[model samples]
Target: MKLSAETLADLHPEISRPAYDRSKVTAGILHVGLGNFHRAHQAIYIDDLLARGGSEEWGILGAGVMPADAQMRDGLKAQDCLYTVLEQDASGDKGRVIGSMTDFAPVSPNHEGILRAMASPSIRIVSLTVTEGGYFVSAETGGFNPDHPAIQADIANPGKPGTIFGAIVEGLRARREAGMVPFTVMSCDNVPHNGEVTRAAVLGIARGQDASLADWIDDKVAFPNGMVDRITPATTEARINHLREAFGLEDARPVFCEPFRQWVLEDKFTDGRPALEEVGVQFVPDVTPYEHMKIRILNGGHAMIAYPGALLGLTYAHDAMAHPLVRGFLEKVETTEVIPIVPPVPDTSLTAYFELIEERFANPRVEDTLSRLCLDGSNRQPKFIVPSAADCLKAGRSIDGLALASALWCRYCFGEGEHHEEIPPNDPSWDRLKEASRVARDNPAAWLQMSDIYGDVGQSPLFREGFTKALNALWENGTEATLQAYLND
Candidate 1:
């Protein structure tokens, strides 16, 4: 089957497709980043909600903000905005064709179409999955960078926007002028307090233009902080071919993820929202406890293994987890240092949650790439790993493992692994990082002195001392031996 609305009925009998009429599904949400995570997580949830009936009006209207997003727009548009989502784990595989997205607006030169779509009264939610760097946040200040080129361009020509936040502000401005209720801005990224992060970015852009408009937005808009979880790997050619050969299905942008999924959101919306509660989306009063727990355990765990895995030339996350030294470092750091400060979830056990993360990381079938985990270290380190180190330092707790993790990141930027093999560029700030790593090879303090990444926390003597020792060990010895030394110490 070609996996279009027309050929969907001809798909394998076991494959699940949409049961409701696609025509009836209206645009109630306009998502900015139409990436694999959004497709696998939120789109799936909305798809499930629609299948249960009475939510046809809440369908998603996908929008692509970046120039690179045109590829996704074309791929989904070719198939009537339909795509396959394959979930794999030890338990089994479940393939579903998600039809939650009705269409994707073209990534215009000036983003006119996107602005119009955002201003639509039907769209009650304007969501985002633009990565941590996409928000134009400075790691040093922990705030929006007003000097970001894209934001500046958007502000200069307020009528025609450049970035997602620009488009969002324009959309909100238009809505306000039309006497309409503003849509809620939802952020589904892995960043801590993602909703607040998004709110700050949007407000940062809006306030730059007009202080009164910023005040109105500050009063009217609802940015709900939420916790989202799902391990979705990039869709490779091999996986795409497997979909075609195994299920007689062919799609351009199919998504692959672990069977496990979770979404805990704050029950705050400016406009009327869907009954996602009926389909297992937890709508709670607070999402901080859940957010911190996941950030420290799941995301922090990924960071703990990523650099070491890359340094060892490991290809997949599961393979990294299978290595005794690699898994030992992760387990030791997560348990002794990381998990100690994790806030209590309502009824969820932290130990059990960590166990689940371990299982997900080690799922061989998922084959989540170590490179994917290792990407964007400069932006990711401040968000994922540094928090644990800062918390441990603040609480006067042991931070050896956390320091080792940071050292591994700096060494990984040295652009080589064991046997001196070439490690490809990973972070957006790779050149600056590699330059610092080379300098720090002789004087390890140079790496920590990166005020942009480490900020004030990098100034702490405790972390500085530990990071220096780890970086030196990694240079003289190898990753495996250095990890062993840490464990033995």
Candidate 2:
């Protein structure tokens, strides 16, 4: 029998075949964005926490800060805020229904409701999955963009704020006035020093409203740096069918992801927090090594393949990884250049990590889209690809592969190629990048001159030579030939 709308009783068998009271749970954390990754990672951790018969204090209250959030809110709400999470591995796929998220508040209608919930003594941690761009950080500088219209609107209207940071700052102010200690602002996004970036954004918005509140936030709120990794792609209808076939149940918002999941967080929580460490969360004094390792290696390698793979007409990341040329290009860049700049990761061999990365990329079932990886190249390049390129240049080393990656991205922005691919709209500055790249065919310095994007690397003779060389090669011989050249060089 199909499940009734209210109680997902039909899902009971799939949720362990044991009847349990969902209402027994209470909300303790308010997650700002209800994205696919969060459902696969953080919510899954909380599910494990509940399974261990502890931290019943840490149920998640999912909230959406924008109109895009409404769809997720409605989907989760329709499923009774319960969805199946399918974890895939080399062995096979396993399934579970994550019932940890208890409630939903769409920020548009319930903006005040969100603030009240946040200000309550019950809510201890405010976590976020708002993508890096949602932070309104300047893509070039990695700082909060005060001039952003959203930032300005949020600053002027603190009570009914529009942006995530504004909502957070307003909530904190309410909590402070109510004699409630602030909660940890946990950022689950994939960015270097994500916690620090989050703190800057909150403070940047708050300082414009009230100086004392900003100072209080610094003194009281705990912004913990975290490194979270998982390969969860956008869920499609095919994915939904796969989940139903595997689990013998239907869930509209089910999250299908690779079995691998890791969350390394700073063990600093002010108000109160979950015993998530019990459920495989590594609470560390510093997550820098892991952060650096993932950022530079996995994410950096992702940036490397994205443009080139997109250029090659490969759609999924696994397909791209399967190609000899794209695979070789990624390995060359990562092993020869990128890894050298990364400090050694703890208790993990960087070599083993790369091997594991290859294995992960080879997982066809995950279906991570190459185009998704290529999106937001403007922001992703500096964080994921540029640092290593700059370091290699400074050390008087060759960046033949790195230069090729950048040129592929530049070519991608041109909106034409073997795929007849109209460049998907990415980055607010795409028009400028396209114009500059068009002009840069003759003047390589034209694209490099963006101080916000390239920094001092633009002025370096080595980077200029490398960029010019690779870009010219791509223009002349194209991506495949350029890859062959780098492989042979």
Give the whole-model CA lDDT for all candidates, comma-separated: 0.90, 0.82
Q: For candidate 2, lDDT tens digit of each residue in 1-489?
A: 222235455554544421335567788899888889999999888888877775677889999877777887787787678777777766777776778888898658437767878887888889998875667666466577888897898888879787778889999998889887788899999988899989998998999999999999999999999999998988899888876665567776878899899999998888768888888999899999999999889998888877888888888988899999999999988889888878987788999999999999889888889878877777788778777788788787777777777778877877677656576666667888888878887876788887777777777787778889988888889889989999998
Positional deviation of 250 in candidate 2, in angstroms? 2.6
Best by TM-score: 1
| Residue-wise C-alpha lDDT for candidate 1, range 258-377, written one tens digit per residue | 999999999889998889999889998999999999888998899889889988888999999999999999999999999998878999999998998999999998989999999998
**TM-scores for the candidates:** 0.98, 0.94
Candidate 1 collision pairs = none
Q: Which window of ten consecutive residues has the lowest lDDT sum in model 1?
A: 109-118
Q: Look at candidate 2 and give me any clashing residue pairs.
A: none
